[model samples]
Target: MSIELLTLCLILSVFLVFVTGLPVAFSLGSVSMLFTIFLWGPHSLQLITHAALGSMTSFMLVAIPLFILMGNILERSGLAETLFKMVYLWMGPVKGGLAIGTVVICTAMAAMVGVIGAGIVTMGVIALPSMLRRGYNKELAMGAIMAGGALGALIPPSVAMILYSSLGKLSIGKMFLGGIIPGLILSFLYMAFIWIKCYLNPSAGPALSSEETVTWRQKFAALRDSILPMALIVLVLGSIFIGAATPTEASAVGAFGAFLTTVFYRKFSWRMLKEACFRTLKLFSMVMWILIGASCFSRFYMAMGAADLVKGLVTGSGINPWLIIIGMQISLIVLGMLMEDYAIIMIAAPIYIPIVTALGFDPLWFGILFIINMQIAVLTPPYGFALFYMKGLSNEITMAQLYRSIIPFVPLQAVGLVLVMIFPKIALWLPGLMFE
Candidate 1:
């Protein structure tokens, strides 16, 4: 069969299997294995082994599990809760104060943890109850938690960016730096959206009553609790941004800092350590397996010359380069609804990256745009991981409520995506300044 026809069949087969409810890793692997054996014989099996080994052994990829472990440890510790409390006190008196505070706390957690689950679950458990008790709207409160937590994917030190850089063969440092401005912008947009919504309808995110206001003394006490936690962020991200440490080294620092925070806060124990390690293993293993499957699938697809087909199809089309880029973004959003972000990246990056580069766009900038779409993906309904994470945390929240909560934030994420696409410098500026 022609490679193009084979590629089409492979795509359909994978999607069909996925529709049958198979796991993403197995869907990608089984299809790739069947095709490789059919096309190239048993000798092609070695490609899968090599891809697994190569993907699992990368030193750069080690940062993923380390950062994950750091986040897990911090999650089990009381540090994130304390950090949220700190922000809650400082912002609690203002309009929509708790939701605004949740964004600040999630942003701070994002800088430290680099994963969404930490912030989402942490705030869901802590802030969600408080917001509900304070008479805030359920959908608005839940929406703020999920949306803010999703920031971890866009912010620096993101595991999503790490995987993207590893697959794209781009600079991990540059990708991390590139995400900063856009991350801050999206965060600001989320906070601004909350303020506007609450301002228009005061019932949605009501400010604390005079009786519930925190005293200045309490605020100072909360600030004191926050100083050390803030220092850890500075120690880790600051080290990377200032060229004092590599990403891998910075991950080590983050993990160690998390450990110290647990111990310093008297939240440490053998059980906590054990739980953190076990959770880390679970999360890290899932990510690695996905990576292995994607690597193998991409290998076989390339061996079948599908990448060239995609390049030819896109480049040969009479479409403008800008339209092609827009089309690619739209496809990502569609695929994102049904697939995990990493799986989508694995399947699409190889095909799209070359097309993007051929169109004269910077890969690092495109990487940031892809990450922003991922931010949207995890908040989109049906299969959004962030939505599930929030619902899992609170029995009070139903799936329908969770879906309704994230609706407004979805468009806000798209706004951020479009801004970065149009003004590449929003992503590139910080990277250029820091790396130069």
Candidate 2:
């Protein structure tokens, strides 16, 4: 069969499997296996084996479970509750303060946990009720939590970034650095939108009543409780920036530090430890299986001259490279609506990275942009992970409300993406400054 026909068949086969509602890992693996056996007489199965083995043995992948363990431990440790208390004590007097504080706490949680599920659910359980009780608009309250929680995809120690950097053969430390600025930019945008909306329409988010406010002394006490968690963030990201540790080593430090936080808070229990480990194992196993399957699928596709075919089409076309880049971003957003962020990275990075480099774009910059797009994806309707997470938070929150909540922040995320795209320095400066 011609490469074009084969490529079309491959795409359709994957789509059909996805429609069948099979797990992503199995879908990719089964499709790749059937194609190999049919096209190459089963002899090519060794290639898939090697690819899966390589993914399993990767040293960088060690960080995934450790970071996950850290996040899980911290999630159960009451740190998010402490941070939310801190934000509430200080910001409650201002209009939209609770919603803005939700964003701030989510950003801090993103630094500590580097995953969205914990942040979204934790904040939803903690901050959402407070905002709603204080008469904050439901859409605004839900949007802030969803958007802020999505920052986990763009912030340091992000498992998504780790996987993207590993698959793209880029520096993990640099990719981590690349995300910091863009993540903060989006956080600021979310907070700004909340403040302005509440400022214009005070009914959307009213200042906390004086009776409900805390004393300045209580506010300071809450700040004291936050110090240890902030220190942990500094330790993890600072070590990477100063070259004191590889990303893997920093992950170890993070995991230990997370345990220490639990100890300090007296939240540690043998049962808590067991639960954290179990959660880590389950999440890491899911990620690794996807990695193995994607490795197999990517290997087969590349072996079939997929790279040359993509390069020829992209380079031979008279389209502007910038337009091509925009097209790729749009495609990623659409894919995000369908696939898990990890699977999208695994499948798309192999095909897109080469084209990005050939077009004279920095892969690191493009990787950060891809992550920002995912930030939007997780909050988008129908299949957005964050949207579902919000719905699962309470039976009262309908899917329709979750969808409407994210409408404003999705565009804010896009603005952040566009800024980074127009000025690569937004994503590249820190990485370049530190490494160069």
Candidate 3:
């Protein structure tokens, strides 16, 4: 078969695997292996071996494990719980305060962990029950959880930034810096919306009773608990943007700092450390496998002139670049409903990255944009993972209710997405200043 035809077949096979519920790593690896043998005869096996080694061996990819380790460590160390508590003590009593607090916590967690599941699942487990228990509107509570959790991808030190850096051959430091402002803007927008919604309806998110409110002294005391975690976030992100450390190096610093913080708080037991290490290895392996598959897959596409085909398709078409970007976001929103966000990224990024770059946009800018869309996707109705994660968190909250829940947050997310697009500066400014 022709290479293009073979690639087409490989793509279909991978899609079938996804539909059949196989793991993404297995789906990609199995299909790629099958097609490699078919296309290159017996020699195809050599390509997989080479690609696997190359993918794992690359220095840029080393950030994956360390970042994963960082996420796992923070998750195990009750970072989310502490953050939620710290924010909740103040925000929780106000109308929509819990919801806003959830977003705040998610934003901070995203900077710390950079993993979607870590943020969503962690918050869902810790915050969902409290929000629901307090008579917060189900949709409001669930939407906030789903949307907030997904913000980790757009923010600095995010796994998406690391992956983007590796794939685009851009500076991880620059990508990290690029994501900082955009992430914060979107986060602020989401929280601001939640606050307003709570203020207007008071029904959407009722304030806590007088007894629920913490005193000024109590709030101040609570802020003290936040100093270590906040310091770690600043140290990791600040070091990167300031050019003192690469993302990998920052990840190391973050991990060590997280460990010490956990140890000082007496939360760092050997069991927790061992499990964190194991989970990190497992998550890291999953991402690396897809990266390897993608790297190998790109070889085929490059050989088939896929990049050229994409360039011609985009440039030759009469469509505007901004429209094309919106279209990509729409497609990601749809795909997010059907595919896992990570898988969606793996499948679409290679094709989309070239197209976006060819349109004269910065890859780091596009990376932040892409991640914001993914954040929306994770909350979008029907198949958003965050919705499902929240559904599992609260039995009283049904799937239909969960789907209904994100109505307000979705528009808020769309607002954030549009704002970032209109002022690419939100995504680009920090990276520019950092590099300059």
The TM-score leader among the candidates is 2
**259-279: candidate 1 lDDT, tens digit per residue:** 998888899998989998998
Better of 2 and 3 by lDDT: 2
Candidate 3, residue 347: the lDDT equals 69
Overall lDDT per candidate, in order of appearance: 0.88, 0.92, 0.79
Candidates arranged by TM-score, highest first: 2, 1, 3
Which regions in candidate 1 have their CA more than 4 angstroms from the true location? Answer: none
The candidate with the higher lDDT, 1 or 3, is 1
lDDT score for candidate 1 against the true structure: 0.88
Candidate 1: pairs in clash: none
Give candidate 2's total backbone clashes: 0
Could you tell me the C-alpha RMSD of candidate 2 in Å?
0.9
Worst-scoring 10-residue span by lDDT in model 1: 306-315
Stretches of model 2 off by over 4 angstroms after superposition: none
